[model samples]
Target: MHQWRTWHRPLVLFAAAMAVMTVVSGVGLLVDDRVLTGAAIWSKPFKFAVSFVVYALALAWMLTLVTRGRRTGWWAGTVVALSSFAEMAIITAQVVRGKRSHFNHATPFDESLFNAMAVTVVVLWAGTLLIAILLLRARIADRASAWAIRSGVSLALVGAGFGFLMTQPTKEQRAAGNLDTADVIGAHAVGVPDGGPSMPLTGWSTTGGDLRIPHFVGMHALQLLPLFLLAVTALAPRFVRLRDPRVRLRLVQVASGAYAAVTALVTWQALRGRPLIHPDGATLTAAALTLAATAAGTYGALRTGSGAHTSPSAEKELVS
Candidate 1:
């Protein structure tokens, strides 16, 4: 296991910054009684702060896993850190002013701020792409971890791209008036307006499909895929099926594909304006197919890579 100090320094500091923001936002949520968009004014900042904390930490840890891309990865990580900070700063500042952070139509100043936030997204995407490219060229010895890192990075990029869907003018927005001068250009929910009945803390829409569902699911693949590998490796001794490196690699690949499938399905559901919990028959059928495919893949991995036919000594040497 890597030590805390060994992780990417800038990203670690960025994570720490987000942690402080989290605390401040939490305090704001408790003390400030103001509401925006039918939710607490501080709610958006608080959620963003917590999310960036996890994101920065995961990215920092990821940077530590490979040795080859240290220089380029460090620079990319710095960009990511800066972008994260700028985004949080904008969100927090808007909260302090008792206003909506995203898709604010209040004044020209707020629109400028939102434009700056959009710039950060572009910078963040570029930095993430650089890091992903570098990671593919990294020299990782463990096949399972290597596959996990590569697939995770690729999927995370896809997830980030899905977020751009929110930037488009909503159907209601277009229907209302001229899109060229629309006050609110972007929204989180697909079918309904921004601030409706939402889930308790996360503010995910219950009345309409939330784009954030796919966005969240996709972005976290960077952490989730690697963690899945960690889980499989940890359970190797207890589970004979997981002991084989080939099996572990196969499982990670299957998981990566399955995760991508899930992200796609949710994005599809959101595009059709279907709430996640209230899936129509098509959504259910797609989900069922995904589940079936994943199960079949898992079984195939176990059957082919169980190490049952190979001698113990040879198998150990081959893996090492």
Candidate 2:
């Protein structure tokens, strides 16, 4: 119980709440088989609920890196938790009503709910941005952890920025004279309408591009980078001797950069109405270059041992 309480800081407790929501959403899927936008009515809620679990946990873990302004962490966590919960509640309500949560303002009531959801999302975004700024400005004991946290938050912001593009009217929508009105906000799929052919379960476009792909990939950078470092720390000592912490840190940096590059490529592909499965030569070349750069960075770090050093306090933090 003490361990649970100790770990269940504001953000962590919010994550626990999200976990409960995830289970409830899963139950909703079994009980409510209604379909919306070519998917199960409960699908959006389930995805968002599970996503909040990740988001809350990531924020909770990252908040520990803040050496100053602990109260700021609490305030930020509360803002994020409340805003996210409100967004989910709105989405679930719409789903229960058998209506689309996003891009739907057919009625005044629907419009009000949609607007509320949008505002909550904006508040959540602002809170996350503030947390990222705090992490970036914070002085940590561990250089590797700091690098991961900063890079992850920076990439998350980039991912969130893509939401604006999703909100913009697509070329087809614009060509069809369907501007951003009260009835329709924006579309998600490119080159084809959203309810068209899609991959099962995920609903990503199988025939066309999906802007959400990049956004989804980029948003998880917070988990990916830090987890990568943690995995390296766990595995390196056992597999290899003379493993320098700096090299591991450098590798994490390279991986983060490569991850961001791939995200950008996918976003570009989606914007161009090109499907991810059908990448052009330019896209392939870009991907190869990113991998090559990552390899080169790793090799340089290993050979030169020129990565930033971690402080003693930071090393202890990493261990804990």
The C-alpha RMSD of each candidate to the native structure, in angstroms, is 1.8, 3.5
Model 1, span 1-320: residue lDDT tens:
44988988999998888889889888988999998888988888888887788778888887886678688899999999999789888888888787776776658898899889989998998898988888888777778888998898888888888778888888898888877666678899989998898889988888899999988888889889999999998998898878877888889989999999999999999889888888999999999999999999999998876546556875676556
Q: Over the stretch 1-320, how does candidate 2's per-residue lDDT look in tens digits?
A: 23344442767777888798889989988998898777888888888888889978888777766767767866887798889889888998898788898878688898889889889988888989988888877887667778888999889878877876777777777777745354766778888888877777677887788888888888889788888888877887674421555667777778888888888989988887777778889888988888888889877766644354556665565534
Give all TM-scores, in the order shown.
0.94, 0.90
Count backbone clashes in candidate 1: 0
Would you list the clashing residue pairs of candidate 1? none
- The TM-score, computed over Cα atoms with residue i paired to residue i, of candidate 1 is 0.94
Per-residue lDDT of 267 in model 1: 91
Query: How much is 153 displaced in model 2, in angstroms?
Result: 1.1
Model 1 alpha-carbon drift over 4 Å, by segment: 307-320
lDDT of 1 at 170: 89
